[model samples]
Target: MKQIVTHADPDLDAIVSAWIAQDFLFQAHASEVLFVSRKVPEKFMQSADCLVDVGNRYEPENYRFDHKPPAFENRNSTCATRLIWEYLLDIGVAVRHLEGLVEITYQGDTHRNSEALKQSRIDGPHAKLKQLKAEYKDPTEIYQQMAFWLRSYTKNL
Candidate 1:
């Protein structure tokens, strides 16, 4: 099975990037989501098929997507989710419809205030994510729930 690794207590960027990797990158195969520390261990660095929002790496050719410096010197404009989404698009994946999702994730990750993002926090995926975080202790559960919700959101969009 393919493994998509990310930091524990994953935020929107990590969860969304991992979700994209699972639902799009490895759509034809089974993938496991593994939560590790922000400082990813050497074992996972070498073993995981993809690392998202962690590992401090942004080499998409190697399937590692992260926006934290020094991986990204200027993180104000991008995040892990956007990096992964763009990579998928480059590979001819049908993900143009997810541009909105990618934009919101970028805004949240970069702490950019926007009317659309603010509205989303009121009742959109952002709201659901906050609720899920409060309701679940396991990060994996939160990711799974959000992944399901994202899949639905994508389909309906």
Candidate 2:
């Protein structure tokens, strides 16, 4: 089994990142995958063949790298969504499918502060995500819908 491990105590951002990474693996590698959302033991991290979202953190010795940009490489960006999206993009995954998620994370990490939200111009994508979050709808619903689509798409290929 392939395990995609999220950061310890993952939030929505982490979950969304995991969802995308999971899909990328399914399409590019194989469909049998599981995402581990808990605080994974270092023992498990060392032992399993897993993809991890360990941002600005230590790299597990055994897992082969598909693509992981170093933290110093992109200081302006926060959150795993951008990192995961960029990695997928490099590997030829159509991450436009995840624009909504990508956007909201940008908003949450950048403009979510009181001062930034007060500014007249939030970036268009982030602004749209802000509006979506305002509606009190679960963001997971969108990713779930995409997961279904990606599964069928992968199987067809």
**TM-score per candidate, chains pooled:** 0.97, 0.51
For model 1, the superposed segments whose C-alpha errors exceed 4 Å read none
CA lDDT, every prediction? 0.91, 0.49
Error of 1 at 46 (Å): 0.9
Residue 11 C-alpha lDDT in model 2: 38
lDDT of 2 by residue, 47-138 (tens): 55544455244332343222224533543345566656766677676776665556555556544544433341364333433444565355
Task: List ranges where model 2 is wrong by over 4 Å.
Answer: 28-40, 51-76, 110-157
Q: Whose lDDT is greatest here?
A: 1
Clashing pairs in 2: none
- Least lDDT summed over 10 consecutive residues: which range in candidate 2? 59-68
lDDT of 2: 0.49
